[model samples]
Target chain A: MPTQANSSEPPELGLSGRKIIYDEDGKPCRSCNTLLDFKFVTGKLTGAEGTKPLSAQAPAECLEKLGTGTVTSAAIGESSSKAYPKEDPPDVNQLGRASWTLLHSVAAKYPNSPSDTQKQEMKQFMTIFSHVYPCGWCAKDFEKFIKHNSPKVDSKEDLGRWICTAHNEVNEKLGKEKFDCDLWKKRWVDGWD
Target chain B: MPTQANSSEPPELGLSGRKIIYDEDGKPCRSCNTLLDFKFVTGKLTGAEGTKPLSAQAPAECLEKLGTGTVTSAAIGESSSKAYPKEDPPDVNQLGRASWTLLHSVAAKYPNSPSDTQKQEMKQFMTIFSHVYPCGWCAKDFEKFIKHNSPKVDSKEDLGRWICTAHNEVNEKLGKEKFDCDLWKKRWVDGWD
Candidate 1:
């Protein structure tokens, strides 16, 4: 279900007459596919070209046509920007699941009454984490999330609830189900005994 | 398969003459279960107690005996330490997977030649990460991993390989299969296509 850059073309035409999802080296750009469309297009649900699914790997005529100087840089940029305004990378789902697991688990173990240093370090860690998160656009969104919500690190309960709400915001954006924040203790800390 | 604190104590005796995983407050300590044993013992692979599995949540008599001033604190500490030796919390696996996902993805996206500030921030992030990792003992092992290998952030390839090797080290300890470092890009950056 992996949609390569070579997934044919949409009805709309770009300046080059095709949207560019890959870079000049034929490497797929991390943000070229939104996780939503990435999920849909790469989903085997999309009809295949023949017996096999579409290979994003094919060196499309559009790719070769690019960098030939016939296509203006501004045209290509405008075209691509129109298509994937908020794309996630190919492995965005993998990255996302892993990040949530870690964030929630860390919040679960936070001290009931954290020291000032612990609280400060946690906030600082979020700042550093946002900077280093693999996906450029996703990181930008996380930065916004942190800026608006900030990290509530005063207590373990505070942090847990805050992170759950943060995760819900992401889920809502992705159109995924929002988890019950009340179940934070059951999911992260105590087993459902 | 979720083991609760009510599970009957192992045959091993502590100062109270019974292994105690839960604290006096009836809350499971974050470091009480190693991810290894957590996977195994809580695994459905283990036969159930009576069509039902053991629960770790039951307030065992040992907890009641602790604060009554009869049992010495030293004895209690010695017993618990001797049993776990090196343990990860209940959600260690969840945390571990998330940490690795973020780590590999970040490495995959690393610039071929990072600026000095970028390199320093990545290294500093690891140090802070090792400290804030949810699992107590797992963090210690990660500290050891960092001490020995250090973060190789010179280039994208350097960091990708380094992170892959680091992941292999953890896999070795956890009895998980080793990943091919050669496939770092294929797994983290690009799709199988």
Candidate 2:
């Protein structure tokens, strides 16, 4: 059964590679196996919150079909060592589908994501966000926020502010008095973004 | 086999669903089936590009496996009307994929697409452009230009002149020494800001 960590707490975010199903000797990649690297260049993970899979994480069946040889894990570094402490309090927002969208918005707004891996993560977040919130109006609002803040952005704080503004506006237009920024923040993290 | 229209001349950009597709009783849908009202709105054409089949037009064999219905078609519009009458052709630099990137740069800069369709199309164009071109540096330059010009932009003519300046700077940096503004003017319809 899949593990279910607290779906509410911010969890530690990291990238993982497939575990090589090796022969008895544990040699390198077998002839029929290919090792794929699933790197989470940046993510928010709190033990209280479960690690939501990025949309890029194919179904287990698909991964099995790819026939990965082995799996390895690595911890993603917090973007700025001085900016965030080693063990910041768990962020409730980084726990669900909403948080995933938030993460993507955050990553996209990051000013200096120079590596291909960062770009890939951002793309994955966008794809997953599309599936959960399939509204054009929402997308328009998000895009507007990103376009304005992307050049000047580089962290989750920037995205949080954008989301705060966008979500409020969207909810207001929908005439829904109950807008859940924190709920969405958790969903964004718990889901994928 | 895919139908080939004029290879040298720009064909008319019209949706196929604009024509009537008669039912067994010979009744036409009051609404046109063109790509928009049919597959696009339903999300069937999400990742489609040139030659990508719309759901309504998918092959019977393909649809049958998925348990679908049949569709009939007749070319309604005159083929001669495909090309636009000479109304100042768009600039050359504004043709094809490159021009599309420029359009998105404008949209991304202004970030208020006319419609959801425009947003979706712009996103698709950006995806394709990113894959085909080393556009990061160029995008930065475009962004810079937009930042400066957006404040003064008031009319289409202003936009055109701004595009002319940005395109020249970009082409110059990319070593496109022979780049002609007249050519870009002709293809400007492709999308420039």
Candidate 3:
């Protein structure tokens, strides 16, 4: 069984036979039921209207109306673990580590005296990277960081140190220990002594 | 002692008290000496000119001229493990995994019916991503892939399927098993069965 909340009707009973809880904004509380409930309620409120209640509907019927097309509870149950049968996708920490690696490696390879084209490309890359980064909140934060401390792409050393300092700022926000900016090359490019 | 290779002069000897090995293309072979050899040789070939021979140069002098500044063999030794002192940056495999996760997640979250702006943005993101991807060889390969099989971004399902197929191409190249495209939604967005 699933839960249901209608914006048109007063928030009362859910499809799971539990009372629907509303947030201060009068939207159904997301934590009240499964993610399906949240989607159903929000979907109804937004575009689709007068959808059949989930309690009275079969899974296929509900999925068809929702335009999700034949989702099964078994699939949802397995996916609840957040791992696919064959592989698990990277989480936030993994994404952070990979992104840092790419950034540092790029800095490591940045020429000491970049051509005008190279410098402009780097700038464009950073701007587009900030916009399209998968994590919306993290991307927004990075955009602000970039605005405050614009990329220094004049030289490799300068760019490396600038990026290191910026990364340290993120570390500070996350309560992680800050890295020494002076050791940027040693850590990222050349082997440490 | 660091090795030396001059593009002007024939590849002969190295400061490591050993002969420098050259690839078929006459570039210094990466396997010989250390990563230092590759950097020094390539650095010489590219920008810095006539930077005295490493054989005659002290570690300090070499570092200064190279603009790498005070790298020690011990530092390289530690970084060889691919882990920084405090943090381990993602290696190629880790980066691949994380990147795939981010790509799939983004595709999953893409709107079923996106605005023109969203469609253009996705296309632009892929183009920039191909250019700025940290791994140079991988970026070149992806560019080829993009050229051959352009992104299908009309709808969320189209985008997801397109990305999954692209990922499969990479997996195939890596000699990894291909994923069943039918299960993409289950694996990425809706849990798997």
User: Native-vs-model 2 lDDT?
Assistant: 0.33
lDDT of 1 at A25: 57
Interface RMSD, candidates in the order listed: 6.8, 21.5, 2.9
lDDT per residue for candidate 1 within B58-157, as digits (tens), equals 3533232332222111121222223211212234444565687788878877788899989998898887788888766678888899999898989999
Per-prediction backbone clash count? 13, 53, 7
User: Chain A TM-score of each model, in the order shown?
Assistant: 0.61, 0.26, 0.57
The residue-by-residue lDDT of candidate 3 on A1-193, one tens digit each, is: 4333434675465443334555455765432233344445555423332344554434533433333222212222243334345432333344566567767766776778888877877777677667666555667888998998888989899888888987898789755667768768666765432
Please list the residue runs of candidate 1 whose C-alpha ends up more than 4 Å from where it truly belongs after superposition. A1-27, A30-90, B1-90
What TM-score does candidate 3 get on C-alpha atoms? 0.56
lDDT for each residue of candidate 3 in B1-193, tens digit (9 for 90 to 100): 4434535775465432334556455755432323434445555323332344454435433433333222212222243434445332333344566577778867865778888878887887787678756555667888899999888889999999999999999888755567778888766765432
For model 1 chain A, give the 10-residue run with minimal summed lDDT: A69-78
Candidate 2 C-alpha lDDT tens digits along A89-113: 1111111223333233343324333
Worst 10 residues of 2 chain A by lDDT: A87-96
TM-scores for every candidate against the unseen true structure: 0.63, 0.22, 0.56
What is the C-alpha local distance difference test score of each model? 0.59, 0.33, 0.59
Over the stretch A1-193, how does candidate 1's per-residue lDDT look in tens digits? Answer: 3333345652122222233244345543443333333323333223342134333443443332332322211121122223212222234455676787788878977889888888988898888788888766778888999999989999999999999998999878754566667767766786443
For candidate 1, the TM-score is 0.63
Going through the candidates in order, their DockQ values are 0.20, 0.01, 0.17
